[model samples]
Target: MMNDESLICEETANFTLGNTFYRSQSKITRDLGVLAAKIYKSEQGRLRVLDAMTGCGVRSIRYYLESDADFIWSNDSNPENKAVIEYNLGFILQKNKGKITYKNANNIFFECFNNKDYYDFVDVDAFGSPNPYLSTVLWATKINGLIYVTCTDGRTGTGHLPENCLQNYGSYGRSHPAAQEQVLRLIIGSSLQEAATMGLGIEPIFAYFSGSTYRVMLRLLPKINLSLDNYGFLGYCHHCGEYTTISYKQLGKVNCYHQQENKYYNYTISGAMWLGNLHNKEYLKTMKNLAISLKWSTVSDLLSIMIHESNFPPYFYTLGEIGRRGKLDIPKRSQLIEALENDGFQATNTHINSQAIKTNASLKQCIEISEKLINNSKVGKIND
Candidate 1:
């Protein structure tokens, strides 16, 4: 039992069992909130935060304690958790008093979006798709504010259902080896479209796959960019494994292939998705520095890797996918990286998948390199 929330909780892995809190996510959520709060404080000073869909008020308290916030609004719809939240807040106030408010709202967005109100940070950690809250969250966020959103519907994100993914995210889906990265693009793209409607723009502050969901923190801006002056699309060529990303203006000329021009065919499109850089280089560098300065144990390592690989191209190549396409055995990750680097192409391991490499090398170059190691006698050195 924690005094602050008077939260008495039984921990269980099975969520189907009634009222069992998922205690395992506590540390991850704590670190993430701390990181978000500190980043907001550095850029915008004191924060006014909303811990939407808060369960038992743990996250709101964590943000209040760890972040440099002036206020925190923790809201949950479930009436059963009201006592638990009150107990925690009552005890918390006894120790460190702050302007922390609690509310029981059946639909959280209506409360946040009701007026000309704004918050420096709006965190929507919803149970499922997060699609329902995207528009409202985008509207409630202040210019120069931050929005940290999560989507637990990995099935739709990873392209398990084409129609459902399209319906929710406005992008037709297909399974790519880089499905997780694709999901990041899906969520960001969806938010961008919603923001653009109000002449707002969002730039990625941080994005990553954590546990069973995808979480992204974005910096909201009041002005919109011309490329995103409208919606967008991703023209993917299955034959050559290449993609051409175009905005609404360029969509008319989009073709899978043009034989005379010698472009690859078999293109199936996915978009109204944000075809933007996944990681912002300078921003990522700053976060990495902050992580180290704060002595964050595990996330710092991941953040460091993300910063180092930040300069690589938007998409990635999987070793197994490349090998299968070439009818050859997959080379060790280090060996593949070595081969690409030897050919003057940059290569690095991706956090998305160990066997996946984020590289500036084209898909053809990657396939060619893999074939060299396999079809040639050079395969002997792979074991060494």
Candidate 2:
């Protein structure tokens, strides 16, 4: 029989996982979190972390060792994993550098709020919906602190369960080409709504989708920033493969602008979600610099894409969609981006999908651009 404990090494930390759920693929997420924590520590001159779902305590260990966190509160609701967590985090426990607790995440937040004890970094790597912690987490987060939230329930966020979407995020989710991005916005917008209720605000440092998981890192602000310009609906036209934003006042006029008076078109609207930039450009640049200094090439590359697409429209069009609508073979993502930029349009590859491009150019413009690129082989394929 295989032993319960297995040695695992990630980045600068070495730990043992014992029957606790550990996803090797999620290492990139952990890397980003650690980098953010390290940056916070450097700026604030101290790092205090509250990891709500410690699992095997890998996050807590990384915060302490890699981020140079001065103190950590690692809590998990399941007591079965206590021994494994303690074993992996024995040094910190013995040194009184942190504490290990078995408590519900909400209870911990409540306790912190009651005691006015807030953390500089609060990470709730929840398995499913983050609704339960969306509001409560703010209670334990210091003003200007960072809150990293996770949502693993893709179905609900992607409109598979529209009913559940309304209940969970206070927004309507509709399945579309940009559903992954939709979910990320939902998480941010929902958190903003919760924060705004308490006269607070938040700015997204980054929103990442790892194929199946959605994670957003937000910086809690001390003032209110809920506005129509930054929170609204996303409208997608099924017929034209186009996207547009709709404000509350535009609800009654929600129709595909591409539709002719006599033509019928299908439109899918998803929101009351975040309509602002998916990432902070300067912050991402800072993270990219740190990643480069640390010799983390993959992270640097990902951040490059994110920085480019940070201020793009809320949705993206896949190469396949462009090709199918234009009745042409799929064009290379890189070439399409080049074509758009040559035409004075903002275009870049989205980190959400490898074959997708997020740009301010309309879908028709993209199709025409793609067609021109395919025909003008001398100009188009060269960029390839």
Tell me the TM-score of each prediction against the true structure: 0.84, 0.96
Candidate 1's displacement at residue 381, Å, is 4.8
Candidate 2 local lDDT, 245-356, one digit each (tens): 9998888676765445666565688989999999999888988999999999999999999999999999999999999999998878999999999999999999999999
User: Candidate 2 — which residues are off by over 4 angstroms?
Assistant: 1-5, 259-266, 378-384
* Residue range 1-384, candidate 1, lDDT tens digits: 333233343221111212524455545555665676777787777788877766766666666666766777777666676655665555445655433444433245565567666778888877778787777787667888888888888888676887899888878767666667778878888888778788988787767776677788888878875265334666566775665567777766666665567864555666666666776767766766777787775777877767767656556888877887777888788888999899998998877776789888877778889888766646566655
In order, candidate lDDTs are 0.70, 0.92
* Distance from true location, Cα of 338 in model 2, Å: 0.4
The per-residue C-alpha lDDT of model 2 at residue 255 equals 73
lDDT of 1 at 177: 65
Separately for all candidates shown, the number of backbone clashes (residues 3 or more apart, or on different chains) is 4, 0
lDDT comparing candidate 2 with the true structure: 0.92
